[model samples]
Structures are given as C-alpha cells and as structure tokens.
Target: MGRRFEEIDWRETPIGAISLRRRLDPALDVDVYEVKLDDEYLMSSLFTVAEVELARLALAELPGADLDVAVGGLGLGHTAAAVLDDRRVRTLTVIEALDEVISWHRRGLLPLASRLTGDPRSRLVRGDFFAAVNDPTGLDPQAPGRRFDAVLVDIDHTPRHVLHPSHAAFYTAAGLHRLASRLRPGGVFALWSDDPPDDRFTGTLAEVFGTVRAHVVTFANHLTGGESANTVYVATHARPAGLA
Candidate 1:
C-alpha cells in the first residue's frame, strides 16, 4: 500500500527553504513527521531512535539530579523530547539558528511540539549555536554566563560534512575549546553524526575535553531493508588542575 504526505508549513530560512511535513510510512505503517531543507530530508519521526539515543546516552554519563542542559538543533523535537525524559534535566535551552524550525515547534505541527515548548524546564531559543558558543554570554541569550552540565548537538551531518560553511568552525578544535569553556566542570559535549566515528574529530574533542568516545547506535533502515547506524560522540570536560 502507498502512503500520503502533507506539507504542514514551509518557509525560507537563512540557509534554504524549510518545510514541515507529515507522511505515512508504508513499511512501518505509521505516521512520520518530517522536516526537510529544500529537497533534502532533515529529519523523520519514524527513524528517530538515534536522535533519542543522542540525548539519553549523553545525559546518562552525567551524575546526580537537576542537571542543566543545552540542545543544538530542534528537529521534530525528538532530541529535546528525549532530554526532557530524564527527570534529572532541570533546564534545557535549545538553540536553533532557523526561526522556521522554531516556529514548527511553536505552531504544534508535531506531536511533541507542545510538550517540548510548554515544558517548564525547557526553553526554545532561536539563535545560532556556533555563534553562541564563541560568545562570552553562552547559548542562553536570556540568561547570559549560564553554563550547562551537558550540550547535545545534532545539527550537521558530521565535523567534516556540514550543511552551512559557517557551521564548519564549530567542529574545529579552537571552536570546541570555546564551547568547553562555557561548560561547568565535569560537563559533557555529545554530538550526533550520520557517518561512523572519525578519529580526527575525536582528536579535536580530546584537545578540549578529558575523554571522548564514539557510540554506534543501530536502527532499521526501511529503504535498505537492513540495519544501519549513526555515531554519537560523547566528550567529558575536564576541570583545570587544582581548580576543584
């Protein structure tokens, strides 16, 4: 049987045209909310296990309760929704450069839209994640100088592969140091990559954080009819010598 797809909203963003769509997956026989940039598929609700795992795995490494976190890129609210699933998450500041993506959440086009936006602990901020990292004020524009226990980013495909030229900087050692500077001691930086783990990126992360590891998250591929995987790189920030 075939399926149906409906475009919920579309808008011109800084990079390209973004569209919010809902489609029925013939293979899964389920509704899949999709976010596309022009003709490229940005995210699909049907295959969000890796996205959800990105948040869960990052938060799992952290210890204790009431943890502050920041999520870069709000795609269909999967990652953000996963972060909120952890009761330890006291506050979540999601940074999205595209205002159109933010509007999708505000407009409640997706199932978790209202929950992610309306959650007392979550704050959806429309801004550039890369720019904010370099800024002395940090990601949350509302509360400057605030630091998070964990920063889970799933914007671009990988460090070597990126959607925009400007985002490439944030994947560098220098740029990552600036991001680490904003983290509280023992904080973590977790990133999602479409490709498998790359040693080059891990080396870059090691320059800033104490330890880095790549986790392979496997999921079913409807198109390929097999299991494929995505990589989640988690790096733990090390406190300065004698700082503690």
Candidate 2:
C-alpha cells in the first residue's frame, strides 16, 4: 500500500495556500485524492459525481457535434476529463486562476493529470476565469472574442458564497450577460454550486438566458453514510428571434 497520507503538492497562491493530498481510505480500499485551499476542502476524488455531471448536463444542452468548450476551474481535473469523454467535443480550454493548480496537472501529480494533459483536445490555460468572461476578448486569449458551444464552471461554492468578493459579481444578472456575450447563439453555461437551489439565482438566470435549470445532484457520502447534494445551474443563451 502507498503511504496512508501524502501531500502531493503545496503552494502559496495569491488567494491562499493550496495543497493536494492523497490518503488511502480503508473503508473503500482506495486511495482518495483531495485538494484544500487554506483550511477549507475544495474537492475530492471520492465524490465527483456532481463535477462530472456539471460537464455532462451542460453538453447535453448543446446540439451539434465538434463542440468547443471552456471549463472555469481545474481543481482535480474531474470536470475537464468529463468534458473530453464526449467524442463530439473537438476542443476544451480550461481557465484556471492559479498556476499552482495547473502545475499539478502538468506534473502528473493528480490522478486524472495524464488523462487531461495528454489529451490533444485539452488546453490548460492559466488565467482568471471570471475576469476572462468579462473581457472583450473573451475566455480564449489565443482567439479574441471567440465563442464556445458550452462553458462549464465549478469554481465558486455558490452564487452567494464566493471564494472572493470579486467573484460575487459573476453571479449577478449583469455579470451573466457578460458571460452570455462570450457564447455563440444557443450556447449553454453551467455552474456547480455547493448550496441548495436558490430561487433568486434562478430568476437572475432567466433574465439572461432562454432556458435555465437547477439540477440537484445527490451522491452517496462515504464518510457520513448518507447522501449529499450539489446544485448545477444550466442556462442556454437565446438566439435572436430570426436566427437559428
């Protein structure tokens, strides 16, 4: 058996100190990978149903093949890997704020590192996701004002509870409009939230997109022996009345 607990990587980022750790879980008899920022747990390999669902549900909203996608966070690479699982996905650009987290994938520190980095379809870009959404050039720095078929985000805990005060604006209707501007017509935007469904946030999404859904994804919690839930908000950009 590998070391029971090993910190794979640790770095002090502008936001806070982040670390990756692996621990053998006796209950499941598997090594569990975890990520923590400061004292707060960010993500875990043990519970990734919702992160994978974030990519699945968003892509389901998209219509055509050869889809170009963008992922906001690169926590454990579960979400990004899920995006690439769809054979229809032609390209994936993951925007990560911390270079440290990106390095974890590039260095093969995380379990899904090779799956993500080795994929020719994936590009791990170091930049602020939220900032890029609002930029006139949009999410892809290489292609200015480039629009995507779908944009999946798992960065913040919730619309109301953000990692930083600056991120709170991205949850607002106006901020969503900025994000919509970065998508092709009929494009979809999906977000993962730790909080339960919020009616107010749903209303905000309705203001920007034609269709909005709040999916409550429940998964078995190994530690608690109970089911825990996460929310995924899927919003589709409405094309002009005459356009396809």
Q: By TM-score, who's the top model here? A: 2
Error of 2 at 28 (Å): 0.4
RMSD of each: 1.8, 0.8
Tens digits of per-residue lDDT, candidate 1, 1-244, equal 2348788898887789989888788778888888888899888887788999999889988988999999999888899999999998899999999888888889887799898978999999988899999887889898899989999999998888899998898988889988988789989999999999898888888888898889999999978989989999999998778965
State the lDDT at 76 in candidate 1. 85
How many backbone clashes can be found in candidate 2?
0
**Can you write out model 2's per-residue Cα lDDT over 108-154, one digit (the tens) per residue?**
98889999999999999999999998888889999999999999999
Q: What's model 1's TM-score? A: 0.95
Q: For model 2, which pairs clash?
A: none
Error of 1 at 5 (Å): 1.8
- Please list the residue runs of candidate 2 whose C-alpha ends up more than 4 Å from where it truly belongs after superposition: none
lDDT scores in order? 0.89, 0.94
